[model samples]
Target: MTGATTLFTGRITRRSMSGLIIAVLLVTPLEAFAYDNPIVTGTVPLRAGLLLLILLGLRTTRITAVEAGQLFLAQALLSMATWSVLLDFDPNRIAVQTLAYGTILPVCTLLIAPKATRRRWAFLVFCVTLYPAVVRLTPENLGLLAQVIATLLVHGASVAALDTHADRAELAGEMADIDPLTGLLNRRAALNELARGVDRSADDQRSAAIVLLDLDHFKQLNDTLGHEAGDDTLRHVAHVLAAFVRPTDHVCRWGGEEFLVVLPDADEALAIDMAERLRLRLVDVGVTASFGVAEVEAADTVTSWVRRADDAMYVAKHEGRNTVHVARRTDRLTVERPGALGAP
Candidate 1:
């Protein structure tokens, strides 16, 4: 495996082990919870063990933002389940734990540097879970609720702050390659994505499609609605395009309000059809886009392929604001450029 892959694996495994430890050392002890009346005299260990395994499973896999959200939600749910097992049927414990856990999610996401896997989200949730159970002396710790909540929030807020810092740190290196307002991949990212698409197509022997889209009368929208609104409009359009794209496909905010869509395994005809679909789809959003699409030639260079698509997009703009044009390049590796090499 590559060094990067090995590093990712190491990180994931480390997190998984930590989660296992938490389940064993901390949560398990809580099973003999109520001093005289054990929360789950026999089943406590079993529940903790199950949670450990599940946490391990999640930490071992690749993570995504959506999964992160679900993990936090799941952790809050699990905390409630754990509370049910406690001998004390204190609604406050259940309410405080569940509500606090829920409230802490966005804060957790904002604070924590994402784990290399989906498990990080779970970790944050687990943290919130452990807090109320540990902090609240008993169900009726009413007077202490404010203090406890304050401490937890402080901790959670700290995590959110840390996460924000980490996200900014990660963004620093790639900031030059992403659109500032919309956070879409920029021109540089598009170039890198183009090379990646071609490599995948060559390896898999599949067709790759490229589409260049430019918003119609985008300036007018800015003029009419204001730049802030224009920015929101741009973000909305990005969400739409992102929804349309497959995970295997690449979509970049090419420049300004223009976008580059790369569809791997799609031929010229297929590329054009998808481009047309984009054109029509934009109407629903009260904005229009023009598209220029191309298929990866046998040995096409980035310049050659992109120039054709770029030209086609203008052609579409000339014919009509919302339309598609198709083009094809016959050569690859025809230009000298940075990061253009086809081999490692």
Candidate 2:
């Protein structure tokens, strides 16, 4: 199968798994309570079914884990009310319900709650579960409360550890894709983004361009002002490039003294305008860069597109540094200098 087809299939499978988990969680309580009392078998399923429908409808709101925990507590309370009103509260039945809730509710909370709110939800569950026992204060009820507290602590700790590990892994992935010197996207990340841009431009039939920038006389600057000055210059240029571009655009440090900007849905004119603006922006920071712009073509690969921009940038350098040069469809060059109305 094609990669796109495989990706679609994988998404469907994941969504199916999520739905199955919810279905199991909804039905498990009904099954557990059914065996305890015959009337519960009839009433619990109806209540759980209605609750599931409500939750399903509210799924679009992106409910948080803490809210999910609270909902579960509400369900438990409703069950208790049913037992008390219809059948008269039996101590043995209440104990059984509490034991079931202590085990299941914490596990559900751990699965859904965000890391920031996980402990809070756990504490809320503990307090809610102990409310019934607190009212009576008998020895056996106190023992039940203790069991619930222990269950929550053990499960909460496990969830917190898992969340910490996941966060570390995510941070490591981000660090790998970032340029340590300039704090811009590194070369690998830039290339990956370009590939995605290419696909999107093709599918949508929209224009896109890549700009290649090289700081003019960078080595001379480094020798005259020291490497520390060179580093500061690069950081300043990176900041200017990032700030000037739209959020939809991407700026990356493509190795020493070089940067690449990917502009989606932009034509050659728009690309040249952006490049010139960037060249002007850096003058305030005591550096100048040569820019080359190339619009996407039907025959272009990622390598070819970048190569075209690179060739145009060299043309800008040859025309006396600190200018914008655009690579035309016919492979000819159009050079734009400061204060010029049209490229010559």
Which is the leading candidate under lDDT?
2
Q: How many backbone clashes does candidate 1 have?
A: 9
Cα deviation of 153, candidate 2, in Å:
6.6
Q: lDDT tens string, model 2, 175-248?
A: 99899998888999899888876775676567899889999888888888999998998888887888888766
Clashes of each: 9, 0
Q: Give the poorly placed runs of model 1, Cα more than 4 Å off.
A: 1-176, 201-205, 328-344
TM-score of each: 0.47, 0.56
lDDT by residue (1-344, candidate 1, tens digit) is 00011212221233544443464447457535643344455655665665565555555534433343345345546645565555464645454554555455544343333446424654555555555554444546654555555666676667657766765886685677777777677778788888867775665566787999888777778888899988898898888877776665667887777888888667888887778787777888888887878888767677877888877766666665578777645422233321232110
Candidate models: Cα lDDT each: 0.63, 0.69
Of candidate 2, the 10-residue stretch with the lowest lDDT total is: 1-10
Q: Mind sharing the TM-score for model 1? A: 0.47
Model 2, residue pairs in steric clash: none
Best by TM-score: 2
